[model samples]
Target: MTDFSGAAFYGLVARLDELIATRPGGADGFSPSARVRTHQNGGYRSAFRGRGMEFDEVRAYQPGDDIRTIDWRVTARTGRTHTKLFQEERERPVLILLDARTFMRFGTRDTFKSVLAAKAAAVLTWVSMEGGDRVGGAVVMPSGIVSHRPQRSRGRILGFVKAMAEATQNGFGAPPPRLEPTLAEAIGRLRQGSRPGTLVFLVSDFHDFDAAAARELNRLSLQCQVTNVFVFDALEAATPRGGHYPVSDGEAISSLNADSAAVRAAYAQRFAARRDAVEALSRQRGMAFIPLQTGDDPAILLHPERMQRTRSGVRGAA
Candidate 1:
């Protein structure tokens, strides 16, 4: 929860525009991959089926269109012929499931993992809103206290950004000082609420939720266009020293330390293994997993190699 004041928000908004504009489409070399589903068709439904051809209009047949719909026998009238029209449905909903859990607080760079998560959510929300799509999401931390309904306006995105900013602020003070929520259950609830075909973004650290949690994500991915953003802290990748450090989640404090060189190496190995497990799950599920680090630039994460202008640079993609 970096002090996300007005300036930071505005900067993020500007960067988002640049990212969306320059991102390449379809399967290519260094394009920012937007997931494409060729085998599935999923989306929302219209409340009413309006009369007349709303999208594709058809000309009235001389004596074909089931007589009842005939233009009141236009021949009896002025001899001119026509039919009333209607429109088709084209709106889709984008649901974002952000995991603002306690583990996200770890960082050794410019900001915490939680701050990066919020920024990503803001960027996605703004992009979807600008694209004339409904945007909504849940800030699943301390257990799911904050969630916004899917909406189709810039104002709604702003409201979501504001709420996320505040939640980040509150979360920074303590992991879950009051009654907080768990990530595993929160994701399950989000899956249940989402409709089929919703472009769902499940943003989180994906830390220590167990097999049940992994299964829930697998289920959600099968039904919707699921995108997983794995938020990570530079600290989690490595420890600064070979000693211990006192860590707390606002509720209790504990020490993680290693005495001998062998023990320290073992500790580091175990830490890396856990991170690898998270990546493995994403790969197994075939979900687009984007790893976001604390020190990394958000613009780079969204646009990938747009910052690089050289042919060789693009040739060597990360």
Candidate 2:
């Protein structure tokens, strides 16, 4: 099993700056630039920062009350003057729910869906962590179990990446306890651990899950900024024009001729319907859906066109 860790993983962080650069810029619209803001911790970096006010406390007004804080009403009642003050809200933690299910274990073009999902998670982690926002997430393993709580800190994010790599190698490569969680299960885990109003990235192939998951996601979105990263393999999506491929499961691999044009067309139609249904369900829930094709460049998936598509989908759904 290839260990996607150490320097190699750190190398991926470098790509984040480029990703941020490619993001649409502006104070409005779905452009990534529009999303840019100062780091909440008072840095000149990052594009998304906290905007809420932190309560400082009431203080007695001195000379320069500006009449706004004169507390005339209070003086009329209590014969004393007081004023309210508050601090700027700092950036909150960003939670990433990584669904490493059996269905995500398959991919045919670039890498396994799980791999791509993890990479995307890593990228987001770096962006958030370096942006001065805390980062943490829950890893949904098979049996619908959660591995950790929603955490904060760069160290915690790195530990998560390491753990995810290990799990992929152990469970997907050659195996011990081969198990995978369903999409609904993963969402449930996330809901349990996430704080309200947290920015969340739910990364998965979104396979073998019921529509109930979509409903739960909608509910979660009411509290958090939810983004869905839908991962898939090119081969699984578009069937190639080739001879029959053998299949086996505790059985011998037998060569069978490829299906006829009509059969292939039927299969393609079925797949198209399935994709449309999934996309539609997500859209109906007013979710930001990012469809990631393994064969395409990751940068392209994060491009303006795709990002705008997500924004429009969410708006239309709303």
Q: Which ten residues in a row have the lowest lDDT in candidate 2?
A: 309-318
lDDT of 2 by residue, 142-208 (tens): 4444555545555666676665554444443343244555666667777776765566788776765
In model 1, the clashing pairs are 52-85, 52-86, 53-86, 54-86, 54-87, 55-87, 142-180, 142-181, 143-181
Per-prediction TM-score to the true structure, in the order listed: 0.65, 0.66
lDDT of 2: 0.56
Instruction: Score candidate 1 by lDDT.
Output: 0.59
Q: What is the C-alpha RMSD of each candidate to the true structure, in Å?
A: 11.2, 9.5
Model 1 Cα shift for residue 201 (angstroms): 1.2
lDDT value, residue 212 of candidate 1: 78
The runs of at least 3 residues in candidate 2 whose Cα sits more than 4 Å from the true structure, single-residue gaps closed, are 1-36, 42-91, 142-144, 173-179, 248-257, 297-318
Q: Write the per-residue lDDT of candidate 1 for residues 253-293, one digit (tens) a residue.
A: 98777456675667667666765665677678666666666
- lDDT scores of the candidates, listed in order: 0.59, 0.56
